[model samples]
Target chain A: MKKLIMIFSLGILFLLSACAGENSASGNSSQSTGNKNSEAGTKDGKQVVTFWHSMGGAGQETLNSIVEDFNNSQDKVQVNAEYQGTYDESLTKFNAVAGTDSAPTMIQTFEIGTMSMINSGNIIPIQEFVDKDGYDMSGLEGNITNYYSLDGKFYSMPFNSSTPVMYYNKDAFKKAGLDPEKAPETFEEVEEASKAIVKSNPNMKGFALQAYGWLWEQLLANQGALLLNNDNGRTDTPTKIGWTEKEGKSIFEWVKRMVDDGTFANYGTNGDNMVAGFLAGDVAMFLQSSASARDVIDNAPFEVGIAFLPYPEDQERQGVVIGGASLWMIDGKPKEESKAAWEFMKYLQTPEVQAKWHVGTGYFAVNPAAYEEDVVKEAWAEKPQLQVTVQQLQSTKSSYATQGALMDMLPQGRKIMETALETVYNGGEVDQAYKTAVQQFNDAIEQANKARKK
Target chain B: MSMNPTLETNETYMYQFERVKKSARMKSFIKGMLFLFPSILLFSVFVFYPMFKTIYLSFYLTDAKGSTTVFVGLENYLNMFTNPIFLQSIKNTFLFVFYTVPPTVLISLFLAILANENLRGIGLFRTIYSSTIGISVAAASVFWLYLFNPTMGLLNKFLEAFGGEPVGWLTDPAWALLSVSVTTIWMNIGFTFLILLGGLQSIDRSLYESAEVEGSGYFYKLRRITIPMLSPTLFFVITVSMINSFQTFGQIDILTQGGPANETSLIVYSIYREAFVNYQFGSASAQAVVLFILILVMTVIQFKLGERRVHYQ
Candidate 1:
């Protein structure tokens, strides 16, 4: 018994010491990594700026190359770009590290997270930095900048911007005896073409849209409708949702009719599934983000056609809001780090870098000057479909509706809207679904306002 | 030296005895403490600390930055109880438990009985039945996602072969919860099968032989002997399966993301969404505390019920 006790005690001591060793080892490793950030700039006499972004795949590679170029441009500053999961995840992680010394010098946040970040009080407004340095903002696209600005003050640098567009399978259109060259420009034309496609091919769905709130918001924007009151929450924080008004009801009715007529496949809220459905020939037409053009062209078994987002025939198209992310400098970082991050941000806006980013990743270059670059011009000549997104943005009018809604609870509001879509698709009454969704949105807004007050 | 020899020897002997006893006791006490120290330290750090912190955080409201802002004092719990989504999540969790536990227990027991028999190539069948145990929740869920895809899925194709229309297994709100439950059951069968198989092997063959000698049929023998003898294992499996069903998250996340109007949103998934997605750590901790209490109540009830029926050798 004594021997057993001794053996047991020895085993426990070994385990305890092993755990201690592991804890200390991990602590040392993390400390070493942290030290490297501080030592990197001092070692080479260059200031180091850490950038946390959510771009992946080709976009990440493009960002890395841009950073490399900036680092080589001068020996004064070195920028390190790190890929941090999806937009929401990156924002969440940024929030987790906000007001902490270990926070990254810069973070890339999506357009939807704009309001939250603005209210976070942890960001150094780009307008401030631009004014302080007298940086030229005249070359940036107005439509993209308008969405990120409040009363003409931009908070973040619009890095990669994208708008929603119509993607049609040209092969499917040909098989259905519809015009392959002409894409639907209005909702009525889309429905007519869908009917013809479905009639020709009984096995295929004529159209499918991701049951996402962003698409609904885009539709409302195209119809010149506000998503929320208080000047789409730009001048003042919104206290109520404006989605249950006339335009919102009209868009909802249109979607309901499409679903009822078997012209639209409700692909839930997953964008990838909707894209896959279209690529697999299960659907003839798909409405998705312009950023998806690269993947669609690469994966589709047939020619893919891209066009502007469809609008209601009666209302003039107001264009779609940008859907990608932007870069923001975190406040409270060292002055040199912030300056280095700002320098890298300015370098990213250069025509050469922007054109490379635009051609390599299918996202719209925020800099209008990027279109003048030979690389962008050549790419546009090769694939004219890429020009449609630029034309849409260029033609857009800067209005309250077009500026997009700025609400801290927009993410939760989107979920509520998606729930309403699901309800309506499942044979529920459209009016009731919309009413319930609006009520939920109002409740969420109230809660958000209360929390913000606290 | 001046004392009597007998008195001196007795005194010395008593003193030596007491000294040895005290030292041995002290040594053993220290050894016992040393043996328990690691587990105690780990449990305190990982389990107890988090539990206490959750309870403590439940009374406060956290800001968007995850920093505690104000003490609300049961307001979080009250809000959760009144929220429709939270109530629905509780219902969905119970429904999942109901859909999965009995079927898992019965199917695993059936497989165990089939595999327990001495027959040609029974080992292969046993291995086949237990292979799912090796598959992680994530890998199994991804495979099930393909199976549950509404279009271009193997499940729909199979249905189409039978002249039935394709069903939206994961997308349809009516079928989403059940679809997730099916995945959970499939993932659980392997572990449950192994446990029941152990129970089956441990049941003495003499009982079955005696029953057979008495002209009892297979069903009668199973009911009279095998079931009573395996009650302890059955009890264990049911309790574990119930707890596992309540805590279902991975399959729901991979298969449906608690969607189609939050039909498959189980309690744990709701907690995760509230905390991580919405950054409502206070409300999430409150929900977590409720879930902990619910599971504790359920475990106690199971124990109480099992005490009545679990037979021991």
Candidate 2:
């Protein structure tokens, strides 16, 4: 009788647990209606929108201010802003919510995902709202749309756009008998400086190049090499990899030499060790996204310096490709809600906000007009080091590789490179490694392309 | 036929209900089915459906706009087999499992025995020894990474006091994987320890008393009685350890990131890189399917071995 009672209770508990799992509510209840910033918050029948952004610290504060301003100006809706953990987490949550059709009306997605998000039938085109509203989109700088426009149709709003740059230790350079002011202009010069720095200071490493292929992609495209075949790797069927050619091979060899000689550390073979290494003072120079500047500054105990990205010898360079995330608008949301989102996006793009974002974070202002604006100009004058990215933009032209990478299996291509890089960094034969990696990556790409034919 | 029609109808309804209620095997099967149905449905949607979809997808072409999935039998499999990194990753994973599982299980067993002894303060010692399990893999790995740094690391610092040269734990490819393995064993020892301890405590004390009456020493009694009685727990611990070792990702990712070289590229991490980081979902799914098959084979082998050898009273 006791055993039967125990069994019956266990069964009862299990059923109750299962029901509880479904009934459990999500992260927020209030924002499911609309944002706290909506003008409707001021009057009756107002909608409330919940927005999840990964931007925190000062970025969150700025967004809160924008929300406050919008709330003060409007009388119909309140936009509630919440901080999501990271870009990856936000997208994962977005994907999950999208299935439930309860997704946040606005999200901050990274640039690499913008095209894929559009093609996934997940998002509404921002161009529609712009064309219909006839809001002064003319205020938007040309470069800002470079992230959102796919086949001339805007898929999302641009936020937190960034390009890679070379950040060096000025004091370390001075100690190594290199110029603190006159940074390396060519890749060879950079290599020489790195070698010199390592030789002079045994405790100090030269370069923190995380993924050599990514760095190679940056330099190769800068040197006018088409890194990908078939519409320059843009959301289309890729016939072949242009990196298989001599120019691409040369870039890999140079990196291999740097790795072999121990002049360059690739962190964890195929990982994001460079940023940590640089910040830890393990290396003297770091090649990374401008977006990393905030963390590096906050974390680094050393004197920091910013410089234009180094180029190959005698190769006039186009600008370094932008390598940050963008926000994509999802469909299935009500028209009014999307319009509420649109208002927030437009407000975010304003010069005052963009300038403030640029100052707090080292990311380049997507709004080129932000450069001409008084606040930004004053900030630049006060801190001349901030203009290094803008200088790269003026010099560099966007390449097929630079504009965007297109692949059915884009991520696998990078993994292949990461593996090859790790192999060689850990003492595997170089030529054999890249050859093997290239074949496998291409194979994965081919297999992926075939799989998408449903 | 001679009975009233209502009585006959009542009899049939009772028979159907009794059929469902009796035959414990049938009842249990139906109950199990009902119990597992929700999880099965979820797994089908998230795991199996995607898996079959990938198998379906592996033969087609995809882009930003649309996908054209077609039948390309054996091509994806052939391609993966020919790939060196994939091949290396499989080998690396096996090596990692081999390195981590035995030492981990044995050391944990040793600790469990020590902790199981009826000392004055045994409970305190057990708690202290088992506390490492609570530290998250990321946090523990971060602490270990700094401690294991070749130069200026605490380990090297202690070693240098003995007049030894600093060893690069993570910098050198040869040692990086093992460095990660040591941390894994340390991190995992507590879990296996607890299992073996529970097994030891549950052993019939009378078995040990009988061994003692036979004039057995501590070691002899341990070998003769305790081990035999604890074989079930040992089997469980070994199986769990091996499965957990095969699934090693967080430590490898946080510490070595499958590198210094591809020394630490476990199969699942490689699968993750392909699926999320590289956006090669189809091949990643293929890899996952292969990994699942491998795991299934391992599990089946374990159960078969356990059936043959495991002694339970």
Docking class of 1: acceptable
- Candidate 1 per-residue C-alpha lDDT over A1-454 given as tens digits, one digit per residue, 9 for 90 to 100: 3234334433433343233223114334433443467446544778888788888877888778888888888999888777767876677667766776657788898888898998889999999899999998878888887888777888999899998899999998998888899998888888889998999987788887777888888988988888899988987889998654777777677778888898877678777777877887888988888877777877889999998888888889887777888999899888888988898899899999999888877898899898999999998888878888888888887888988999888887887888788877766788998888888788878767766664
- Ten residues in a row with the worst lDDT in model 1 chain A? A15-24
Clashing pairs in 1: none
lDDT per residue for candidate 2 within B1-313, as digits (tens), equals 3889999999999998888778877889999999999978976765556557756766543343224345455555676797666787899888888889899888988899999888998889999888888988889999998887644479878977998865668756778778988999999898889888998999988888887888889998888778887877787777667667766677876777666556678887777555545545555557766776776577568767764566677
DockQ of each: 0.23, 0.28
Q: What would the per-residue lDDT of candidate 2 be over residues A1-454, giving only the tens digit for each residue? A: 3234334433433333222222113333433533334334333565666576787665667667777877777776667776765665565446545634457777777654654576567778888888898866656545555535667777777777777788888888999999998888777887888898998887678876666445556666676776557755665567567664566565566667777767876565423446666766668887776766666666778777887777767667665666666666667777777777787778778777777778767777776667777777886776666777767765666556557565435545655676676666666777787787778766665665555552
DockQ of 2: 0.28
Model 1 — TM-score against the truth? 0.88
Candidate 2 segments whose C-alpha is farther than 4 A from its true place? A1-46, A50-77, A81-89, A136-141, A144-147, A212-214, A234-236, A269-273, A372-378, A398-401, B1-68, B71-78, B135-172, B278-282, B303-309
Error of 2 at B218 (Å): 2.8
Native contacts kept, each candidate:
0.26, 0.43
Report, for every candidate in turn, its global Cα lDDT versus the true structure: 0.82, 0.68
